[model samples]
Target: MTDDTGYEFFEHTADVGMRASGGSLAELFAHAARGLVALVAEDSAIRPAETRAVRLRAASVEALLRAWLSELLMWFDTDRFLPAEYALGAVSATALEGEVRGERFDPARHTYGTEVKGVTRHQFRVEQRDGGWTANVIFDV
Candidate 1:
């Protein structure tokens, strides 16, 4: 789905794809994370009442993106955590450190969306072009 935000979802064969673009790497990552959250739960229903610290390392930017999204997915899978805000302290080609602020899922108060089983590497990419960063990720439902 296309929106005013820097992120949009595309139709995949049996999955969902997300494309996010931003002026910087950190902004791009944040937009990608937001897209993932949107897929798992309604963003408007989440609250920034809790904070979770995140630190990840990978061999490349593509791998880092996968790890970042996977960590977020893990949180959702384990505790039904839905992130509302992302405060990235640092983002590099191989590492990322940040804090995600959000609350756990409460059926009475939150609206659940699709159940994202995992982040897929198929057609996954993170690239910088024309002074901007763009990321394309597909989630398996």
Candidate 2:
């Protein structure tokens, strides 16, 4: 379970499940975003050719994280954006904002993995334990 990457993937029947942990909630969310990118494109294949701002407000931390990741997925589904890097500007229980750096999807360069349709509400969780924060998310791939 300790890949030293701060994130890991777990088996699921239909969708994919991911767990990301860090010393802080912000880092946990950042790693979760990275986990999503790792599932889509190879880390080295994606370049920071463009930047986009992400902002979301939810009722709780778990909801906020889901919305943030779902918003990124929307870019890929709608505009073919593939984000490989993220800079978290702000992350809180009720709101989140960040800057994502990546380029338009290029099949020739980027290696696509599971195509995540959406973030699921089932089996989703966010909590703090052992001096760290953890976020468990499932994607409708």
Candidate 3:
């Protein structure tokens, strides 16, 4: 994350890669969710008109990260929810509980640059360095 507590997009051949970092794991994961939002819409314009509690279980932190994003993406594609703010409550290597805040994706009001079809495991990672934490994830466009 640079100026904002957010994530950055990396150039991928046919998809997109995200590098999310923060002072803590919850922050990093929240930024990662913001990264996914950045991939689809303008975060600043998205109003927190609704909130959805997201819960997931995984075999590892990496899997949990992907599952979290995947659940959000599923909401976008199926439930039409476009998340902007992430309120990560409890998170561990195997479990996560969080709430995503954003209203349903209204194409008339929201500006989406691209359509992220799915999240991929390729080059997916979650690591904690001495200073902070970071994660890398790829998305299928």
Which predicted model would earn the best lDDT? 1
Instruction: List model 3 lDDT by residue over 65-134, tens digit each.
Output: 8888888888888877887777888888789988888888787877867788888989988888878888
TM-score of each: 0.94, 0.91, 0.91
lDDT of 1 by residue, 10-37 (tens): 9888999999987877888888988988
Worst 10 residues of 1 by lDDT: 1-10
Superposed on all Cα atoms, the candidates' RMSDs to the truth, in angstroms, are: 1.6, 1.5, 1.6
Clashing pairs in 2: none
Indicate which candidate wins on TM-score. 1
Tens-digit per-residue lDDT, 27-90, candidate 2 = 8887888888888775647788899988889999988889888888889889889887778878
Q: Which stretches of candidate 1 lie over 4 Å from their true place?
A: 1-3
- Which residue runs of candidate 2 sit more than 4 Å off their true CA positions? 42-44
Candidate 3 RMSD computed on C-alpha atoms after optimal superposition onto the true structure: 1.6
How badly does each model clash, as a count of residue pairs? 0, 0, 0
Q: Please give the distance, in angstroms, between residue 80's alpha carbon in candidate 1 and its true position after superposition.
A: 0.8
Model 2, poorest ten-residue lDDT window? Answer: 38-47
